[model samples]
Target: MFGFLKRKIKEFITGTKKEIEKETKEEKGPGERAIERAEKEIREKTKKEEKEKVEEKPKEKSEKKEAIEEFEEKGKKEKLEEKEEKEAEEKRDGLFTRFKKIFVSKKLGEDDFNNFFDKLELILIENNVALEAIDALRENLRKELVGKEIKRKELEKEIENALKNAISSLLIDSFDLIEKIKTELKEKKPYVIVFFGINGSGKTTTIAKIAYMLKTHNITSVLAAADTFRAASIEQLEKHGKNLGIEVIKQKYGADPAAVAFDAIAHAKAKAIDTVLIDTAGRMHTKTDLLREMEKICRVAKPSLKIFVGEAITGNDAVEQAKAFNETVGIDAIILTKADVDEKGGATISVSHVTKKPILFLGVGQEYGDLKRFNKKEILEKIFD
Candidate 1:
């Protein structure tokens, strides 16, 4: 997972380190050069004065003046040496202190960070990261890295830490779906959850996975074929229900999807079911119509939780979809499908932050056991560790 993004980040870090090191090595300190020039001029002036005095002044007076000149020059040299020694001693306190003076001067300046972040921004954009997320990442990294002291050999690790911290901050925390259901079941008979997403996004499969997951936890659930718009949408859900040994409450095609959801909720109440998983159609091309229909379902079913399911490989598209859904019906959580095949994994990073919702699960494969809970630490490890 995140294979493409991982490789790109590695390349970016290496490239940034090279640029910084090259600039540091090539940089010229005008202060040292000016000091050397001034000292040389002073020495030459003293020597010329001594020569003139030796030629024109009395011998004893010339010698006395020469001795005084030599003593003053020695004092000046000693002062310069003492200043350099003290500065060196201060810098030599620790390896980090020494490298701080060596690597990019005192600290990473805004200009240096901006130059390197431009490369990181391009990598993120190419990998389908959303603009808002990229902006947040830039700010977070700038806060952590810009004006910060770092060692030369640890540059890559420093960048990784900042990137990881920024990415972690972007993702909202996920809640355990099972634990939530168990808690809600104490107050209600069935916890109703409606799944929303565009067509061909594996919404039906994800519902089945959720139901299977609930079953394994000894939480009985019934599938609601609320997607009556498509021709075979009901059958698709019924097939999953059959396979999982769960019941499907459905109506004929062209039926009101909201009515289907209401019936499923009623069924769960009648049969003492633990949860109700409602499936909806993906008529995203007509977003207005889709939202109106989803709103009706929400009104009729009064679902406890609304989940926006999306394809992980869709990247920014998934984020936009989740944003639209949340704006319309306010999604409670998210589930990203086909995550196992996602190389860039931009959606995994962008969706939650875009919608301000936690991602509950990642559908990793086709099997019932393929549903993996979303974990922030695991994501960081996979990308960087």
Candidate 2:
């Protein structure tokens, strides 16, 4: 899964590690070199002063004069040695103090990660990640990677771990559909769940898959074909109902969609159904009239859960659609379709982060059994491996 994105990210990490290692080997840091030069100068000056003192000794003198001169010379030498020792200590302190300043800052320098992150941003854009999501990831990576010195041999592994953690933080939100439905059923005999998405996002198929999944757990559900705007939509849903042996409640095209949903809820209530899965028309989020109509459906149905269906292969478009639907009707969760075909897989990562919603499932293939529950650990492993 996500083979293209995975390969790109891995290659970038490896290439960056090699570049940093090469730079570290070819050139030493300025701070270390400055300290080395200061120590060399101090040693040379000390040796020259000692040699000059030795050459200045007198050959002969009277005993008393020699003794007095010797005492005076001893005092002058002691004072001179003290002054030199203090100056040397100050020079040493000044050199190493400047060196310590280089290592104590809380953020990495531009030289540490600027080039690497610039390339990463470009790669994410090429892979169709949303600009907002890309910015969020960049900020997160900076926080995780900065303030730490790079270790040569361990640099790759450290970067990989940080990236994994950053992605997981954005995508991981725990949700269990079956358990949630079971709990909802306790309060109301028929729990209504409405699904909406843009046209051709595989919304109908996802509804059918959800119905099939419910049946396996011995829970009964009714499908509400409330998508009255599209004539084929109602028929498509009816076909899915027939295949699954579940009842579909629908009305004629051009009829009010909110009425269809109300009727479905009434039927579910009358029949004591365990759940009601309502499929809305695949209208573009940009259409204000259609969006208002969707809002009417939500107001009338008052569903326990509102889910948005999105196509993973659609990339940033999917993220935008999800955001619009969420703003209009307030989606509680998401289900991404065509994940198996999405080599870039940017929508899956971007949508959840942008919407602050959990992804409940992934549509991997055509069969009903192809729906897979979203797992953050498995996803990170696939991307980083």
Candidate 3:
């Protein structure tokens, strides 16, 4: 899952590290050469002074004066040699320290970060991350890395952590669905939930999965076949109901969807059912008529929660659908289907942040038990750990 995006992110980190290292080497090359040249000049100057001192000799001096002068000259030459050796050692140590500093104390300036982020932005876009989510991630990472000092050895880990944090921030905090249902059941006899999405997004299957999950927790629920427009939509719900051994409340095709929702809520109330899962008709988000029908269902059912279901593989399209539904009906949570097969995983990353809603679950597979609750830690770890 998310294999492609994960690989791309890892590659970006490593490639950025290498680029920075290469640039640092190039930037410091000239200064290093200058230091070497200065060292060589000092050594040549010391050798030339020694040669001139040896070549110059006074032949007309007295023996005592010549002897004293010879002793002084020898002492001075010894001292000069010692001083030259110490200076040379100091110069070498200074150069070595500067070289080590390049790797051990490299700081990322603002310009360097901007250059790196340009590549990251393209990677994210190619992976299907929404522009708004990308902008948020960019700002978060910029704050973390720009103008910050980082050791060359620790660069990759630092970048990973920063990216993890930035992505983690994009996901809204999710609540426990089972606990929320149980809590709501304490006061209200039946908890109503309505599912919204476009066609072929696995909406019905996800509803069944949720029902199965609730049933496992000993919470009884009834299925509402409110999707009256689509052909065989009622039969599909009935099939899932049969598989789950849960009763399905439905009317004939072309019946009022809102009326169907109202009937389902009434059935739940009469039966003292713990919850009512209303599956609405899937249509294009751009279709105002369909959106209005969804609103009517919500108005009639007065659902405790409204969920937007989307396909994880659709990426930004799924995000836009969620956003539109949220704008129209105010979705409380989200569920992305086909997550197991989604290699990009951008919808999972962008949906919550874009809609300002929490993702309740992910439809990983076809089984009823394949609905995995969304957890931020697992997501971060999957991409970076």
Candidate 4:
């Protein structure tokens, strides 16, 4: 579904990995080289000492002169040995200090990621990823990749692994809507779900798809045509109900939406319906009166779940819309429509992460069966494969 975004992300990761490998290969860390230099100096000093001792040897001397000269030479040699040992100790201390600095500097240095993250941020913005989401990812990548002393040979693989982990963290969260509904049906009788979204976001169609899905599982549900403001919204719900052979509880146009939802819930309770899916009017997030109406519906219906429907192809707009709805009515989850046609499916990541909610399903196509349960593993694999 996210073909364009996937390609861009993969390219960014590959490019970043190559840059890290190149940098690591070209410049050796100071700590390793410092240790090597210290060892070489020690070896050279030892060789020079041995050569000096051999050159100082003399022959044909009296016992007294030989003994005196031997004693003097022994003292000088001992003094020289002490001086060399002191120098060696200082050198070892310096080497250790350098090593300590390297260890402490293990976190990702600013120089290492500045250029790389700049390019990545641009790529994400171009793909319509929300600025907040991009920032979150950047911070996470820094946490995963920074300051770690990865070997030059392992740089690429290490970077790739970190990127994978960061992406998964951003995408994965526990959400099982079907299971939740099944459990709720036992205690709640008819689990009510209110769907909200802006106009042209495919909210009505998504409602139908969910109803059809539930029917397949032998879960009975009633449709609430609570979208009284929209001209054809009620007719739309009735049409879906007729096709699915499910009951539709609707009021006339210009009716109070909250009353329609209340009636729907009451009907579901009396009929022992498994669920009551309430479809609300498509309203702009900026419209205060419309948002108030939504609040009234929430208060009156007391829905078990509030779902926000959005168009994945709308990109950042969808994210903003979802946020606005959540702020006003507090959504429990999300459903993204038109995923099959959305090349840059940044809205999916943006909405879920920004709102701290799970995406229940993806509308991949126009057919009722095109609804796909949101799977974090499958989505990540598709993007990174």
TM-scores, all candidates, are 0.82, 0.80, 0.84, 0.78
lDDT of 3 by residue, 97-200 (tens): 67566645467888888888899999898889999999999899999998788877788899999999999999998999999999988998799999999888
Candidate 3 has an lDDT of 0.88
Tens digits of per-residue lDDT for model 4, 1-385 = 7899888977887787677656654454675677668767866776687557545643333344667787887677678767766776787668766654544322358667767789978877888889888888888889887677765446556766776676667774647777889988778788989999988798889999999999998899999999888888888889989999999998899999999999998998898899999998887746687679999999998888999999999999999988988988899999999999998878877778889888889999988788899988887777777
The CA lDDT at 109 in model 2 is 61
Q: Which pairs, if any, clash in model 3?
A: none
Candidates in order have lDDT scores of 0.86, 0.85, 0.88, 0.82
- Best model per TM-score: 3
Q: Could you tell me how far off, in angstroms, the CA of residue 210 lies in candidate 1 after the best superposition? A: 0.5
Top candidate on lDDT is 3
lDDT of 1: 0.86
Off by over 4 Å in 4: 29-108
- Give the true-structure RMSD of model 2: 8.7
lDDT score for residue 186 of model 2: 85
After superposing candidate 3 on the true structure, give the runs of residues whose Cα lies further than 4 Å from its correct spot: 30-99, 102-104
The segments of candidate 1 whose C-alpha lies over 4 angstroms from its true place after superposition are 28-106
lDDT of 2 at 230: 72
| Model 3, residue 332: C-alpha shift (Å) | 0.4
Return whichever of 1 and 3 wins on lDDT. Answer: 3
**TM-score of model 3 relative to the true fold?**
0.84
